[model samples]
Target: MLLILLGVLVLHLIILVLLLVSTAANAWTIGSTGSTDLWYKCLTTNGGYHCLPASNEDWIQAVQALMVLSVLFCFFSLIAFLYQLFRLVKGGRFFFTAVFQILASLFVMCGAIIYTVMSPDRDVSSSFGYAYVLAWVAFPLSLISGLIYIILRKRE
Candidate 1:
């Protein structure tokens, strides 16, 4: 039981870290000359690199907000889980944690999907980057973790 709880904790932590990196890393879109992310577009010029703010598109802003919310909710879920772990009696389920985690997964999914479909096509030479892939990877991990939390029960 202890091992199982520890594993779950580790899994939650991993999801949290992945979400943070996915949201913050400036590599959602990559090109031969530069890269772009939620916050900035960086281009390598002849002698130096230049950066500009991301587009003002509503969908892009929505994606950015969702991603930030996902990270916040996931972090809060972890804190709640730890708190409940100590306060709850044996056989109690981590429902609140599960709910928050599931919501986080949903937010990530929505953000990624929006970015994929609504992104500007001007950068025809660009391709999706590692951070974008990480967002997708984190989604499943977060969903699985939420499901595990729903099924898990406190035990002595």
Candidate 2:
């Protein structure tokens, strides 16, 4: 039981970290000379790297909002999980945590899909970057974690 609890905690933590990294890392789209993220578009020039605020496109803004919300919800879910772990009675389910986590995963999925559909096709050289991949990766993990939380009953 201890090992199972620890494993769930670790998985939750991993999802949270992945959400943070995917939200903050400026590598959603990578081009030959630059990269673009939710907040900034950065490029490398002659011995210098420059960054500028992301465009005001509605899709980009939506993605930004969704990603931020995902991180917030995931973090909140972790806190809720910890709180419930100690306070809940034996046989109680972590429903609150599961709901928050599932919502976080949905947010991530929506944000990534919006970015993929709306991002400009800069050129043949440009491609989705590691951070984009991470966002995609986190979505399923979060979903799975949420399901696990739903099924996990507090044990004495």
Candidate 3:
């Protein structure tokens, strides 16, 4: 039982870290000339790189907000999980934690989808970056963690 709980905690922490990295890293889209992310558009020129704040598009702002919200909710779920570990009844499920985590997953998925569909930089030379892949990876892991929480029951 202890080992199982520890594994779940580790998984949740990994998901949290992934979310943070995906949200903050400026490598969502990469091209020959530069890269663009949620926060910045970096262009490489004359052996140097120049960065500018991302465009003020409402959709980009929405993605930013969703990513931030996802991080917050995932962090909250972790805290809730720890609290419930000690306070919950033996048979109780971590429903609140599960809900928060699930919401976090949904937010990540939505944000990534919006970015993929709405992004205007569809040049043939560019490709999606690792950070974008991380967002997608985090989505499933977070969802799985939430499902695990829902299925878990405290055992003494």
Candidate 4:
């Protein structure tokens, strides 16, 4: 039981780190000369990089908000899990933690999908970058961790 609990905690922490990186790193889309992220669009200049504020398009704003919300909810779920671990009854389940985590996963999925469909398509050389991939990867892991929380029972 102790080992199982430790594993779950570690998994939750990893997911949290992934979410933070995916949200903050400026590399959602990458091309030979530049990269774009939720916050900024950076292009290589003659000898340096020029970064401009991200476009004001509605979809980009939506993605930004969703990613922020996902991080918030995931962090909240981790706190809930720790609190419940000490306060919950022996047979109680981590329902609140599970629900928050599931919501976080959904937010991540929605954000990624919006970015995929709405990102500019003119650049044939551009490709999704590591931060974007990390967001997609975090989605399933978060969902699985939420399910585990739902099934976990407190034991002595």
Per-candidate TM-scores read: 0.96, 0.97, 0.98, 0.98
> Tens digits of per-residue lDDT for model 3 on 80-142?
999999999989999999999999999999999999999998699999999999999999999
TM-score computed on alpha carbons, candidate 3: 0.98
Candidate 2 lDDT over residue span 1-156, tens digit each: 889999999999999999999999999999999999999999999979999999998999999999999999999999999999999999999999999999999999999999998999457999999999999999999999999999999999
- Which portions of model 2 show Cα errors greater than 4 Å? none
Q: List model 4 lDDT by residue over 1-156, tens digit each.
A: 999999999999999999999999998999988999999999998989999999999999999999999999999999999999999999999999999999999999999999999998338799999999999999999999999999999999
Worst-scoring 10-residue span by lDDT in model 3: 118-127
How well is each residue in 86-113 modelled by candidate 1, as lDDT tens digits?
9989899999999999999999999999
lDDT per prediction? 0.94, 0.95, 0.97, 0.97
- Alpha-carbon runs more than 4 Å astray in model 3: none
Which residues of candidate 1, in runs, are more than 4 Å off? 121-124
Off by over 4 Å in 4: none
